[model samples]
Target: MKAEAERRGYQKKMEAEKEREKPKPLSEKILLQNDVIFACKDIARNSLNYPDSFEVENTNSGIDNQNGKQIYYFTLDYSGVNAFNVRGTHTIECYGTIGDLSHSVTHKIFN
Candidate 1:
């Protein structure tokens, strides 16, 4: 029983040391509101019909609890005629974090 207790205590100490050596997530706020907006606009222009007719709207930002990262949410509104000569509007919902804007998720809300 004494040997077993010492082994368990040594394992716990090693585990604690490993946890302390792990790298922590960045705590600095590096991205600004305009940066997120610009990234969204760029994505919209590349994937939508008319690049010049889209605008960013309804932007919101919040900190994610799981990873302690800033998450930005916004919508893109496009109003113009497509290649089919049909005039209509489109809305896209987008979200992304500071260091991962290029991989932002965009979903077409309506068309």
Candidate 2:
């Protein structure tokens, strides 16, 4: 009976030690906010290389300035976010009637 009790105790101790040695998963929730700026200009006036009309449309991701010309500003409110999903560059997309264009911006949160 004493030998069986000692074996059970030793097994419990080993299980505890194993649990302590295991690495815990790394995860964290964070709040992300920033202003996304979209600069636009008339193609005819700005050397014929810019869009005639450009603006941001509201989507599931966030909100933006609805001015739709010259400059469009956006405020992001991504709260309770996961670290892994946001660990890279963020892309802000605005539609230009002439064609579709996208700008890639770096996120400082990773740094």
Candidate 3:
């Protein structure tokens, strides 16, 4: 019974450590600080020939760590006119880190 109690204590400690290591939910202010919106707008401008007529709607976002580096993921929905003046929506997935401004558009879907 003593050994079992010790094992359970160790397990509880391990569970608490795991919970502490998990990433917390990102806030809108942090997104702005990371320039996520600007990156989305830049992508829209490059993809579509519109003059700032596009609207950026953030569908989802998350934070993760890779190789000890904090990486940010964003999914944005853009609604605006295309190069041919056809109105449509675009879904863009972006991932990058802070400080270097190294954001990249991973995927884009036209609708």
Candidate 4:
């Protein structure tokens, strides 16, 4: 009947609305690249109680630093990203400045 079809259409619209409200998660795996001049050790040595602004948050799996190994493990925070297509991958940025030197690094996280 016409009423049944209308009800079905209403239900479908509701389902579609729900789907639109819920965005598909970006990814589960994140890789962080060390774009600084020094390794973790050097960074730690230079920084002393400094404040870093990290734009993303995630769980860290581990660190990889070898040929073509440009990634670190981390969990993803969906609330961090406000825009899309910014970074081919999602990342958290940590920025710090000291005297004439400024350091910035990004960490990618997984789902």
Candidate order by decreasing TM-score? 3, 1, 4, 2
Q: Which residue runs does candidate 2 get wrong by more than 4 Å?
A: 29-111
- Higher-scoring candidate on TM-score, 2 or 3: 3
What TM-score does prediction 1 earn?
0.44
lDDT of 3 by residue, 1-111 (tens): 999999999999999999999999976447543576567657765776674777765577787788887767777787878667787777887766653444443445555
**lDDT ranking of the models:** 3, 1, 4, 2
Error of 2 at 106 (Å): 3.2
lDDT of 4 by residue, 67-88 (tens): 5543343333322222342322
Better of 2 and 4 by lDDT: 4
How close to the true structure is residue 8 of candidate 4, measured as C-alpha lDDT? 100
Residue pairs clashing, model 2: none
Model 1 lDDT-worst window of ten:
26-35
Q: What is the TM-score of candidate 2?
A: 0.28
Q: Which ten residues in a row have the lowest lDDT in candidate 2?
A: 27-36
Error at 16, model 1, angstroms = 51
RMSD of 2: 17.7
What would the per-residue lDDT of candidate 1 be over residues 1-111, giving only the tens digit for each residue? 999999999999999999999988644244444555576667666666766655454444454543776565666675556788666666666666655645455444566
